[model samples]
Target: MTSSTDRVAIVTGGSGGIGRVSVERLARDGLAVVVHYAGNKDRADETVASVVDAGGRAIAVGGDVADEHRMGAVFDAAEQEFGGVDVLVHTAGIMPLSPIAQLDLDTFDRVQRTNVRGTFVVDQLAAKRMRAGGAIVNFSTSVTRLQIPGYGAYAASKGAVEALTLILARELRGRDITVNAVSPGPTATPLFFEGKTPEQIDGIAGANPMGRLGTPEDIAEMVSFLAGPARWVNGQVLYVNGGAA
Candidate 1:
């Protein structure tokens, strides 16, 4: 089991909703966190400030998680600031709503690039750099099970992530590292509430068994545990929704 002391982690997309929460949680858990943001430099700085204010170590970095060179620099930052990365939490992704007929091939390619290929690139870097006692946690969505309309392409990309995670775990069998994915149900993020009115937001929340949208902190809790001492759990897709799915 890894101790929550002096460990280092790289959280891709660490500036956004769930990513911010995960970075904060990991930093609080005693990991020197590298906050990876594609853009949103202000938000990334805010994440770093929040962690430092809480007496934890953290730094914000900008990079495309799908870019091998960028990801390598991220790993390098983790080592330069702290030591080596003991954990990786990839939460960077894009979701575009469209029916199969209306789905833009350009958007589909971008989603695959960011979601599926991004996970692959970062996971590959983690696998190569992380020593024994390391752990990797990925982000997926509960849409795979909910089969929500307009999410066909998005869910398909995440499905690839799920499969990659499972296979990668087995590929690393006998190593002390564990790879897993987290799938959250409808969450009350900007993405979820975007373009929706108050009534629509309530309606969406009402559809969930929990009667509410998920909070970033809620998902972060699971991420914290998975990346921490729970080394025994490997290659599992943990659903963080409140029984919504």
Candidate 2:
């Protein structure tokens, strides 16, 4: 009964924000999803509930993207449950924004560990397990293009991600797989609006050409395209920022 159409997917950081939305969208698009979260089992369970409610297949799994052994188990679980992975979405990242002059080495290290190294780890694992025609989509930030103030450390980490993705695309050319990054502008997620008031969030949204902060669903739509039936769209960093950057 199974074919390439029933292949599995893993979305890292699926507990919240864009990750949660991506998981739901991929499930709706008909891929069996492994909802990978670092912590927050409650939120992860909520994500799974949403997917199953919509008549999709999903399971919540916990692992640190930057940890190899833990990620290995995540891969093993996906294979055991759904046969093998055909899509990998690396959305697990940390962004602590501060000017380099005020930034401590510890903050920079953490950002790199989660955003840069974490991406590399997940991509490598996906490549190992994915069949030809598979896709690995990573997350980057539009700040790398806009060079926004107070985002030096965070942008540097994503900048590394951009570079890694370009090389990865070429490295896996023979496999007929696609590796790409999706760079999103400011969106109205808890991560983006955590401490901001409603007015503050509105002001941020008003700056975009679309006159609104992006929803997680907006980003998830792009992920769905890259993961399924868009195999020709490979190794490219598609921006979903609504002309803000």
Candidate 3:
């Protein structure tokens, strides 16, 4: 395993929500981090400032996750700034909720482009460029198992992420790299709170055995593990849902 001091990580969607927290968490773990944002430059700057204040090395880069050229630039920025990438936590994704029958084809396509294609693009770059003993973590959703009514398209996108994660792990045979996915349950990020009623949120939180909503920090901790010492734990989707299953 690579030592934290020598490791470099690129965290896509590192500007806000779970991605923001994951950047800080990995930085705290002693890895130099490249924080990737889609359009929110201000938020991305804030995340970088927080890491700097904490005495961790970090730089923010902007790009659309699904765009191959843009994401290649993200990887390029990491190598230029910190040498080479050793870990990639791909948290950049969208969650647009709509029933399958009512969901427009455009929305469905957008969801796939961002979530599924995004994972593939970044994972491909990481597979080719990341140093040996690297880790590639893709984000998935617990809703795939929950089968929530309005999550059809979103869940379908994450399902593809999970499949890619498993296949990529096997594809990287003899490379000593670990590929895995983190399936998070209802997390209390802006994404989850948006369009959610208080009663609905409460009901969902109560359904979990932990009786509380998962936090961005909770998911970050899992990513930190996978990005570091969890070498034997590859090609698996570790669900971090507080026993919500």
Candidate 4:
């Protein structure tokens, strides 16, 4: 197992929601964290400040996840600031729900670009640069299995992520690095609550066997395990839903 001080991580979308909590968790675990944000510099700065206040090292970087050059700079910043990157938690994604029949072509393309293309760009960079013992964790959704209506476009994007997660793990065979995806079900994040009503939210929570919404920390704990000592658990998509699927 790698000691926390020797580990460095770049957490995309680390400025908010699940990403923010993951940053804090990893920092507390002693990893120097690079918090990547697409916009919202203030939130990113806040996250970094929180990490530092807790006596952990952290820096905030900004970039579009789909832009290869820009994301390359994100990796560059991590290496320049904290030696080399050891873990990457790709938590940046967009979910614009629409039925296939009514889904705007523009919206569909945008989602694909951010969710699918973005994962490809970052994963490619991580695969090339991460050290032998590194780990790459991509975010996916349980909706792909739930097959809920109005989630066709969103699910399709994440479906691509799941495919990449599996194929990339196999591609990295001889390397000690592990690649996996975390599929969370109905987490209590702003993204999940954006267009949802209280009744709708309650319905989703009740659908899970645990009868509650998953928390960002719940997902982060699993990520911490994968990013650190879970060496044998590769090429798998661990669904973090409460037995929802």
Candidate 5:
């Protein structure tokens, strides 16, 4: 097993939102990190700075999550900089909501590419290259169970993620690498707030028994666990939602 301080991680979407917080959390846990961004180099750099400021090692890399070559480069960077990647916290995805009937085919395809294909790209690389005793935490949404009307495209995309995550865990048998997904319910991230109004946010928060939106930190804590210590926990979608059902 890699010592905690010697472990390294690649956090896709580490530029902003939950991914950013997860990077910080993992860094604090003593892992060198490769912070990935889709288009926000500045945000990724800032995330890296935060880790570096805290006396951790980190570097920011930008790429399209669904692009194999680009994502390959991300892994390459992690290897080049930190020796090799031990954990992959794949929090990079899109949530463009529209009722199924109203959603355009183009938008639907984009959602699939970013969410499903992106997951495949990164997970495939990690499955092939990540060190044993590492973990993969793929992001999923509780809306898949919530059956929210306008979330058709987004939810469907995450459904694919769930399936891929489960199957990969089985396929990686005997590798000592744990693969799992985190299903978050109404986390207070920019993605969740994209088209939501204040009232809508309030209503969703009220629905959760906790009566508050899940913060990025809340989700990051779970990421920290799955990546660092949850060795026996594998092939499950751990719902971090505050019992919003």
Candidate 6:
């Protein structure tokens, strides 16, 4: 069995806001980290630097999450670097909003490709290769339940993610590996603020009972818990939205 301090984690989208925080949090917990970025090596390097500077082990790897061969190389890197993979924090996804009526089929396909297909690609690799005591924390959205307008395509992709998480948990039965998804609501990431106005942001922040946006650190705490101490928390979608849903 890998010691807690020697466990390894691969955090996809680790160049982005929430992913970067999750990587640092996991590294702080003593797990060596592989920071997976799609195309942003600079940001990914920054993420890796944070961990390395803190005296933790980390490396940056870039490739499309939906590319099996490419992402497989990412897993290979982790195994080569840290002995084996124990935790997979899959936070790689994209969001582009448009009402169903005005939806571009091309955009919808792209969303499905990146969000849904990308998850399947990485999860498939993790399912087969991750150590027995490992965990897989895939990202979903509260919009699946919130059913907000203009989120049709994005929500659909995540909906598939939730479904996949449930079944994967069962399929990994007796493997000691846990599979789950984190459903965040209106987080204050650049992804969330992409096409909205100040009024819109304020409106969203006010909609939640907490009356504030969720920080990346807020979500990273949950990721840390799931990737480490959340052994029994399998096949669940933890909605970390500050009581918004």
Per-residue C-alpha lDDT of model 6 across residues 1-245, encoded as one tens digit per residue: 46779899999999888999999999999999999999899999998998999999999999999999999999999999989999999999999999999999999999999999999999999999999899999999999999999999999999999999999999999999999999998898999999899999999999999999999999999999989888889999999999986
Off by over 4 Å in 1: none
Candidate 1, residues 163-201: lDDT per residue as tens digits? 999999999988789999999988878888776789978
lDDT of candidates 1 onward, in order: 0.90, 0.88, 0.95, 0.96, 0.94, 0.94
Looking at model 1, which ten-residue stretch has the lowest summed lDDT? 1-10
**Model with the higher TM-score, candidate 1 or 6:** 6
Task: Give the worst 10-residue stretch by lDDT in candidate 5.
Answer: 93-102
TM-score of each: 0.97, 0.95, 0.99, 0.99, 0.99, 0.99
Worst 10 residues of 4 by lDDT: 1-10
Candidate 5 residue-wise lDDT at 15: 92
lDDT of 4: 0.96
| Candidate 6 Cα RMSD (Å) | 0.8
Candidate 2 structure quality by residue, lDDT tens digits, 36-56: 999899999999999999999
Give the RMSD in angstroms, all C-alphas superposed, for model 3.
0.6
lDDT of 5 by residue, 93-137 (tens): 988878888999999999999999999999999999999899999
Better of 1 and 2 by lDDT: 1
**lDDT, residue 236, candidate 1:** 94
Q: Write the per-residue lDDT of candidate 4 for residues 69-110, one digit (tens) a residue.
A: 999999999999999989999999999988899999999999
